[model samples]
Target: MTGTRSVRPGIRFAAAGFILAVLLSAPRAEPPPLTLAILPLKLLDTSGEPIDQGPEHARRLAAMARGLAEDLDAGGDYRSLLVTAETLRARCPDERPDCLLAVAREAGASRVFVGVVHKSSTLILQLFARVADARTGRAVLTRDLNFRGDTDEAWRRAGVFLAGQIREAGP
Candidate 1:
């Protein structure tokens, strides 16, 4: 009986060692982070009238762009390409799809985020954002949000909500 008990312990020890060795010998791989380029949001007046959005609104738009890039980078799953609006414009002078694709290639980003903020009415603002494959220019995910007020805080809140939605959608 004692011999039988000793053999059982030895067998368990050998099995555990083998399992550990196999696990250690197996290759471990980590997926590469998604390289993302967040572009500035374009502004449009949906009412077909030229609305003068003052310099303050311009600053707010810039802030939202930076906020989007920061949020995506801090998520730890994406490598955000730090591309300024000027740099992007320099790379692609026109708003053509091909120009945008060329800029994405220049930035070395696998994915690109294009967005727009539209003023539909005096009290209504709409945001449209999309993540597209840089190589194919196909949209992977798109989100649109409407909110009241045109204040900086309102825009910031919208940005936060959009970022959260994008993170949950895994792009």
Candidate 2:
């Protein structure tokens, strides 16, 4: 009887340990990524000089916004969507937080990313970007980058840097 009791306890301990090991080794399911609406980046040229708002500039802006979305989406943290300037203006006339949040909600996004490129001159540009919670109108991430040169490559690199910052700041 004594030997049987000792063996029973050993079996129970082994069974418990095996169950714990299996549970610990099981793959955990990650939660779905949050939906994010990336609004068209606005240009605020404060250079006090006429810089051509030509097709090239427009193309660069569009590409920058698209690249940001793609970069964020690739990180598996956010399901990024694009919202055009016209759409945002039509939906929310004001730039207030509440208005922005309403626009984000309408786009079925839990968060919104907005940015403005401030051009001091043809050689200098300052980019300000922020991510805000649509529900609370609270900013989750904000970053500003100043880069030299007005070339496509410079703008593209700036977007990449901003995206890396956002990824590090996770949703």
Candidate 3:
């Protein structure tokens, strides 16, 4: 039975010491998250119907966009810069790549996000989002999703789902 104690105390102590040293020497600080600028969502009517160009629709879309930015920020993967609809309109005015780049540069953001919500019918809506890199002027992430029901709650849920997907996909 005494022969079973082949492992020595000195070796165990050395192993523990090595592990402790490694743990103590490892870097504890993480790099800062990439700054992401969230632009206002574009509301479009794709059903060939005369769309209501009212302020209510614009406000709702802006609210949803803000919620998405907040969700992404809460995920702790990105530093979200949520721009107001009015500011975004005054700055970009369109969802062109060049405009997005300008906004990113002005905001000092590495990444910029733009989204469009197209209503095809009373109960069908399509949401499309794209994130572009300011340095490269290329899209880094893009997502498209459809939601049923013409209610604010449904739109909010879709926004939440999109944010979760973006976060899950990583920065």
- How many residue pairs clash per model? 0, 0, 0
**Ranking under TM-score, best-scoring first?**
2, 1, 3
Clashing pairs in model 2, backbone N/Cα/C closer than 3 A: none
Candidate scoring better on lDDT of 2 and 3: 2
Candidate 2 lDDT by residue in tens digits, 1-171: 989998998999999999999999999889999899998888887777665666777898899999999999999998998988788788777877788788889879999998999888889999999899888978888888999988999999999999999889888
Worst 10 residues of 2 by lDDT: 46-55
lDDT by candidate, in order shown:
0.83, 0.88, 0.82
Question: What is the clash count of model 1?
Answer: 0
Candidate 3: tens digits of C-alpha lDDT, residues 25-118: 9999887887888877888876665766557667769878789888988878888887666775787676567876777778889988888889
The candidate scoring highest on TM-score is 2
Error of 1 at 19 (Å): 5.3
Runs of candidate 3 exceeding 4 Å displacement: 1-27, 48-53, 88-90, 93-96
TM-score of 1: 0.79
Candidate 1 local lDDT, 1-171, one digit each (tens): 989998999999999999999999999886777888887778886655466665767888888888887887788778877567787677767778878876887789999889899887767999999989999999999998998888888899999888888888884
Q: What is the lDDT for 44 in model 2? A: 82
User: Which candidate, 1 or 2, has the higher TM-score?
Assistant: 2
